[model samples]
Target: MDPPEQLALREVFTAACRAQRAEVLATAVRRFASAILTNLAARPVADLLADYFKPVALYAICELVGIPATQRAVVAESAETMAASMDGVLDPERRAAAIGSRTALSRVVDSCLRSSDGSGVLGHVARNHRRLDVPRSVLVHSFRLLLSPGYMSVATAAANAFVALRAHNLPLTCLSRDTGVDELLRYCGPVQALGRLCRSDFDFRGTPVRKGELVLALLGAANRDPERFPGADDIRLDRRPNPHLAFGWGTHSCLGTSTARLVLSAAFGRLADQFPAAELVSEPRYAVRAVVRAPEALPVRLTRGSEGAIR
Candidate 1:
């Protein structure tokens, strides 16, 4: 985050806190979930969860950031392109894809400038763009920051929820019923870790750290912390009190925290109502990322429905 964009994000965050409430986020998630359920009718929920969640989650963020709805696909494509390049296997095809996606995103930003309405994130940047303090590159990177952090988070989260349903054999009836959603979230926290560079020397749980030292805030460990959660090693889907840090803590908490909750809430609700007997055909290929931890590939099988119906 550059100084100028940093200034902009502070403004956006300040405005978001004052203007939008929590339920607004929840409503957005429900709408996204309904769309997924409709398109994924009779299909394995996990297979398509990532695909739908991205566009939906991206749109919600764009809307919140003040990006117009018309350019959602364009923003999502840019995000998807950026995400693909993170894999340790870079190649010509991947580079080409990213270049193309970046081109599209730039075009979207250009379009926003042309639009007289100017109502989205691009709108914010264009409307509030500074000549000296904030350069064009700075604004672009700042918008990219909002997209970069949450893409993998939302995708992994959707898949994590799908996996839990498979492992537990939870039924579709639960989606409509008043069941424990937080418990599932706590038990299978979508993110396994977050990054932090120690600001100063400190000791935590007998481990010593120094200033500027990079640290992995083990999310899996925190979620399963025995001190906070009894029997932390086990997954308690109906946990009474789940004080996990799946969304991190302090200043760097996920910017899309509310948006993330919405994506997961909607995704799981529809998934539970759709596929009740989905199971993993093979163990998920867990990602090796230090920050984002989730399955790179989660191949699963459907024993019921045409693809996910009642079999």
Candidate 2:
């Protein structure tokens, strides 16, 4: 993506956040949680992620971007294909698929912008595109970015948070306090690590680093470091003064931190409240991706008569 495109995309999110357009994100969270309940109706329990969260996240993203339901599957497939290329481990066939999907996704996003159902972040951007002077390609790239990480991260984070809550057997009320949520975010480390290029020579403890070298900050390890966080190995529900960098730190920290927290808290909080007896039927099967890590399957047995049935 070119600088202009990047800037325009940045503006879209920054502007949306500035306008306090969190209601859309909140609705998406509720819809995601409801999907889990819907799946439970068919089966006593299902893969919390694959069976429910994935589809819900995909649908919620489309809803957020004004992508019509009719075109959602195609758009979603394209976005997924494109995202698979991000870890830079694509074979020739996969590379070709990524390129093709990028083309298709760009076209689909262009169509949506032209005739949006007229709502959500995309709608706001479309209405202000001329004012922002953002190019069609820029908007398309932005949509792709939003659809992939913007959706996947929140869904995966919520699932992981629930897993932590289950492991610790903590109550939903714990998450009501900000400290509880912070510890959850720290313990989960959804993004895992961030790669940074050294601009100048630096020394670490005893080892020396050269300029222009790539270094991966292992956020998950850091968050679990006992030195920084006492009893870090244990999931302290109300771990306070937590300086965990789950959302990354410094200049390029995640822009969606607040939104992500709200989504996770709302989703998991409801799950805990509704299915207090929900128990894991099997171990979580995680995706093998190194860059962004989350469980592919989280099988759980839910209580038969849960209060918060999807209405």
Candidate 3:
């Protein structure tokens, strides 16, 4: 990477840390938390917990990437259809949503770039984008990157942790507090897998990996690597020096990762506080998909909990 590129990334990182990234994530967290709470307060029997995590994550991602309101639905729809197409449900709505989302996201990013003021990530990314002459593909790439956090891995991790919590007679309420969320992320593998494309020839152990090939980094596998963690499968909430790779490493590292952690911390903290006695009544099933693999749908009865109105 050139010095200019390095400088650009550094600037963006600095700007991201300056509150834009945190703000975007906090906004998302608030929306998601409110959505769930509203549902709880209004509905009588609310239990499609994991599924509820998806749309909030999706909409938040759109806003973060500056996906134009005109095309936000399309981008969301297209991405969903693209995923579903592999499963044989290529609906026309998804196609339209995708195409529109891409277009809108592209335009909004452009507007953001032209207005750079070191004031917002939008302007910062725009200034750097123009300086770098970023391509349209980056818009799609960024959208995809931001899309996963709220609903997919982060939510799955929460669900899986919920399962583990119940199986061990642990309280879901503990998660709502600030205690043990980081350990939960480390132990549960919030992001089940991460991917990399070889930019240069490099050797993995003994095998030579040439440029332009896909490399799958199994975060779940690495987190469980015995040499790295003793009794790898065990969950030790007090575990330290974790060195877990729930978030990828290097330049292309996940931009929203810290933000994801914050959102999760808040959500789980609330869960711990609100439903201290909730219990799971069904066997949780896991799902596997390209790039991300883990539980897709988590169902629970909330069998025993505070006498709060659950939506």
Cα lDDT tens digits for candidate 2, 1-311: 43454566676666865564577667666766775675575677767776655666666566656677787777767866755555655345656778888888788777767874566666677777786665567668767766666567666776787677767766555565567778877888567776778878999998899898999888889999989999888878767789888766654556666766666666666566566566678779887666667787789777644433311
* Candidate 3 residue spans exceeding 4 A from truth: 1-10, 21-35, 41-44, 55-120, 127-129, 136-140, 148-151, 173-179, 288-290, 303-311
* Clash tally for model 3: 16
Candidate 1, which segments miss by more than 4 Å at Cα? 1-11, 17-32, 42-46, 66-74, 84-116, 120-139, 172-182, 203-208, 238-240, 274-290, 297-311
* Rank list by TM-score: 2, 3, 1
For residue 61, give model 2's deviation from the true position in Å: 3.7
* Leading candidate by TM-score: 2
Each model's TM-score, in the order given?
0.70, 0.79, 0.72
Candidate 3 local lDDT, 116-174, one digit each (tens) = 35244454465555455445466435545455343355555666676666666655544
Please give the lDDT score for candidate 2. 0.69
Q: Score candidate 1 by TM-score against the native.
A: 0.70
Model 2 spans with C-alpha error above 4 angstroms = 1-12, 23-32, 35-39, 90-96, 131-136, 172-177, 198-212, 304-311
Please give, for residues 20-132, the per-residue lDDT of candidate 1 as tens digits: 55577667766776776566555543455455555566656766666667767677767766665554243556666777777777666666656666664555456555543
